[model samples]
Target: MPDISPLLALPGAVAGAGTTADHYGDLVAEQRMLAAGRAIVDLSDRGVITVTGPDRLTWLDSLTSQSLATLDAGQSAETLLLDPNGRLEHSIRIIDDGVTAWLLVEASQTAALAAWLDRMRFMLRVEVADVSQQWATLGQLLPVGSPPLVEPAAPNGVPLVWHDPWSAVQVGGWQYAAEDGHPAAEFPAVEILVERDRLAEVGVAARAGELPVAGALALEALRIAAWRPRFGGEVDDRTIPHELDWLRSAVHLSKGCYRGQETVAKVHNLGHPPRRLVMLHLDGSDALLPGHGAPVLHEGAAVGTITSSARHHELGPIALAVVKRSLDPAAALVVEVDGVAIAAAQQVIVPTDAGATAGVPRLPRLGAVQRPQA
Candidate 1:
């Protein structure tokens, strides 16, 4: 899992699932330190893949959901690799530095995703390499609208700072979340790429109280509060960007042909996504957090499934669930966690009528029947 033995030696550090730290003795204090920008989270479990060659940007643009053909140096964007059916396969945090495109993704996805990309590079000039072993990730809270402050630039001179674009809609993107007061409006966070060998330095500093360090759990809480859809947690084999409001940042509606662009356009224009995403405020009377894949029930019938849940420092228990689009927007739901049903109130993230095409002209359906009386 990325060999976090260096961090495990630190006081209060506890091993967490999937190469993460569960907490640092006091989770609440760790979260507070993170929110206040006094601590950073070790995200060594994340992976990095670098693509080089002259055709890198254009080749990638032609394949993924985002428009990357014109990406400039230091530009950051998120893209989705979709299957032929438009199901999400991979979600990449992209940054180009004039020479190479660095794709940051979940650690578990690194090997498979890299292998897939390598096979796709048949005649193209692009060269893909998994650089995860050499690079690690660090995350921290930042002031809203502020950039990450990294002293020494990445070896590629790219800074490798992904200032989350979730705060606002990009030029060619759309937001399905409530626009008046999106939760992500105040969720300021960033992930910075650092040398893998240097993680020990960070751990030492954190233990000495020089550089405050939090656990991945704190970051999860903040991400859930922001209604952010993570790749491994919120996505499934049937997931489309439309279902998770991912178009808000990842997809460019007018982008040219890609593998799954047809479905993207079709659903966005005339059809609604089969499922919709919601933020659930869980009843925390029992002080329990629903597990991922927990069944979300409406009137005792399964209507959705919780993708991720967390106990926020301030927000108590919160979760992101994907429910059937036909379900009532205000339906009172219950999440079954470990055989215990917990009350859940929905906060609309993807509206019931999300993906409605406003002005797009409709065309007649094929095979019109003409019945004549003889």
Candidate 2:
């Protein structure tokens, strides 16, 4: 199994579970149950960081792209950390519990994000710590029953539940998708924090069928179906928020200056992103799904590569890819998987004219003489 899931059966998923956690033995059923809000995803392997003190909110506001100063307690917000040139460096899922702001990130991002925050705190009264050792995370949809089987509690007085904000655009955000039929509304996901010591308890409950459990495979498929963009999966060195339709939630266009703000602003106000995100519906006749980094080709020429690929229970083989913004939206394409070319039809997520939101008009050329009205 790989980092995603045995649920996907990408390479060895048919034999072993993927890299993260348990395979749960029944991926199909897991997908069905999880999508229906009857199951929970085991995300204990992810990372958790905490920011403390009175200046935590204000300090964070000055550093990240989102307006965090006014973030209310128990509220969910997503923000991006980009380089000076506006390329994605980190994606932070934030939930402030009044006293402490809990930063949920991929396990691989814990050390780097903590270190960056630590170095940026000059005189502000703030403290950052990677508390993954003490805390764990679990994901699920809104409860199917009247009452949730597991209630999230904050032992430290800060509520531990972080409702996902990807279901809709956030304040000070912009959306680039030209259509309104996005399935994001179907993904009412949330993350809950629990003490690491409770993992054994949760496992026992799951094993006894008192609660349902899912794996990365089941969870990721639902994400693809919703056309959601993730951190490590959908992001790359050249990635900017506009390219992924990430501005819908992870970016604040009007927020004051932060690292990469210039590029974000310029791209949205005067230019289009170099690349755009799209969902590829792969041919499933072979029952073989392309893995990450698989080549997307037009006329046998490489145009882009698949970021994340999965075999969705309902949608079959699907993937997210970043292709040239100039690629024709209606052009037929193909994805290469393990030396075989799989037919792929694109479903546009971000449009070619995604940016230039400011609508700046073009000026006449400097060397060209002004012409009279024809």
Candidate 3:
């Protein structure tokens, strides 16, 4: 986990007594600011992989599910790394600094992914290096055109965009990016390292100038509303990228060969994905539901399992579940937590037909009302 102690001094950071852990130190303080929307989270827990050398673009294109050739210096994309069986290995954000490319992934998977990439470098002329510590990352959702130099791409087909300090692209929404120092000759964005203690100062500066600091919980809520699946929670070696509705943002059907190309094309063109990811509105408490592997039942029969859960103050207990695709969305299901059946209503957030099937609603806008439980 990223060190968030720097956030403690920020206004409205901790609402109560804070605790420290071996991994996630000062989580209580982080959670409090996250709940109240008054702090900016240091997303340095995300690992960064730098792809340099002349053959970087071609090398990456042949290795991932997305089309790397289309990305320019100021653009970014969400792509997936798949296993031999087309199972999800990682969900990554690909940022191009004009010359070199950077891959951002969950911290825990950094070493494994780095090793895997290194092993696959058969005379590709690409150098893969871990740059996680050399740089710091922060994310915030700003209004369209709020930042002067930011490129935006809505990978999930939602209103939100991935903003960075680059020439802005007018996708569905606006995203802004800012770097600390001058970017490399090929990369256009500025790159700088802000000290941990200076994050609050940056936040204060941003707010004073009209930019608001959005915490992790709020970002998670935004992701849930957009139906974006997290890697560890909704994706794993047991499931393919299509099962998690990642095809829209991560996997490009038209991309060239990669590690899991065969299985991906086979399931996509010929077969239906067995399990599907769905959003659930829990009826009962504001507390979070059991996380990954928790059972979901219908009339005492096992139906599916909970993958991720969060306590949204406005939405009560909300969760994401990977259930049998054949199960009716309107059907009432129960998430079994500690032998207790917690009522959960399902909503198909990502339509397999990409809006051709009109059963599910589109991603909600910021501050939209929660879907009422039946």
Top model number, lDDT: 1
Report the lDDT tens digits of candidate 1 across residue range 214-330. 888888888889898899899988999999999989999898889988899889887899999999999999888888898999889999999998889998899999999988977
Off by over 4 Å in 1: 144-152, 359-374
List runs of model 3 lying over 4 Å from the truth: 1-5, 8-39, 148-212, 285-288, 350-374
lDDT head-to-head 1 vs 3, winner: 1
Tens-place lDDT per residue, model 2, 1-374, is: 11332223222223223234544677788899988889888776688999999999888888888999999888999999999999999999999989999999988888999999999888889999999878877888764233344677686676688888889888898889865798888888888888777766776777666887777778889999898999969998899999999988888888788999999999999999999999999899888888888889999788888998887888888999999999998888999878788999999999988998888788989899998999
State the lDDT at 364 in candidate 3: 85
lDDT of 1 at 167: 76
TM-score of 2: 0.93
TM-score of 3: 0.72
